[model samples]
Target: MDKNEFLTVDEIIELTGFKKQSCQCEALTANGFSYAKDAEGRPKLTWTHVNAVLNGQINVVAYENERPNFGAI
Candidate 1:
């Protein structure tokens, strides 16, 4: 857990408990996203991607609140 190191996909998944294909990882590699993969393919997602995903900047649709039906109102 040093500043020079990062977690792998499984680690991130375990830390965040985010399901597979969630934006926690996808947000890392996304264009214009806070972080990207290093040459070794490890993401700085812990700092950048996790927050964005939590804040709805990425992978938002999956966590949406269910729309309420008003009975044709």
Candidate 2:
């Protein structure tokens, strides 16, 4: 596996500061982040996804267990 290929669950957790995959998944979904699942059916955020979030290329409205407030949208 390439070192720059994909971001693991732990890496994503640390990067996004979420405790679990479900929480991270919800955040990613809210922010329109596209990721893939591992062989064990776990979500793996790719480098692109991380970069987009970190670099502000994408809208990350939530972190650390705070869900996006879609306020009647």
Candidate 3:
């Protein structure tokens, strides 16, 4: 969790299998994701934050899937 290492949006998308969207950004932020604007003003997430989310230390509701209802057999 080096503060110097930062992941780009594309990396996050690839790692999390999430489609690029504003909603995803919002979800990440809500889930304890720490981001800072790069020189281009693009949001850059710290590896610490990414790992936190991946390790379940940070929970994102939007990324959670609802349990399937199978009805009665």
Candidate 4:
């Protein structure tokens, strides 16, 4: 997979409109994005998740425990 597959810290900052990492993570979490944190504690969001959310392939709140359909992409 490409390294650019994940949203960078700057992109996450811009997306959530938050300068603080904690706040950004919280905002993403509130929006139902399942993310992992890097060694520096920065949130890591995959393009797949973003695409799934944007394409309405899955419900943010309801699909918390469900795996997104990777084949659809």
Q: Can you rank all candidates by TM-score, best first?
A: 4, 2, 3, 1
Candidate 4 per-residue C-alpha lDDT over 1-73 given as tens digits, one digit per residue, 9 for 90 to 100: 8999999878888888998999998998777777899999999989998888778886875776576778899
Per-model CA lDDT versus the true structure: 0.53, 0.69, 0.64, 0.84
* Rank ordering of all candidates by lDDT, starting from the highest: 4, 2, 3, 1
Per-model TM-score on C-alpha atoms: 0.29, 0.55, 0.44, 0.78
Q: Where does the lowest 10-residue lDDT sum fall in candidate 3?
A: 60-69
lDDT digits (tens) for residues 3-58 of candidate 3: 56877677767654566555556656656665666685556777776787779876
lDDT of 2 by residue, 27-57 (tens): 7666667677778656787787668776888
Clash pairs (backbone) in predicted model 2: none
Off by over 4 Å in 3: 1-4, 15-24, 58-73
Of the pair 1 and 2, which is ahead by lDDT?
2
The Cα RMSD in angstroms, rounded to one decimal, for candidate 4 relative to the true structure is 7.7
Model 4 TM-score, all chains together = 0.78
Best-matching candidate per TM-score: 4
lDDT of 1 by residue, 22-72 (tens): 455564333333455577545455555555766777654443334345776
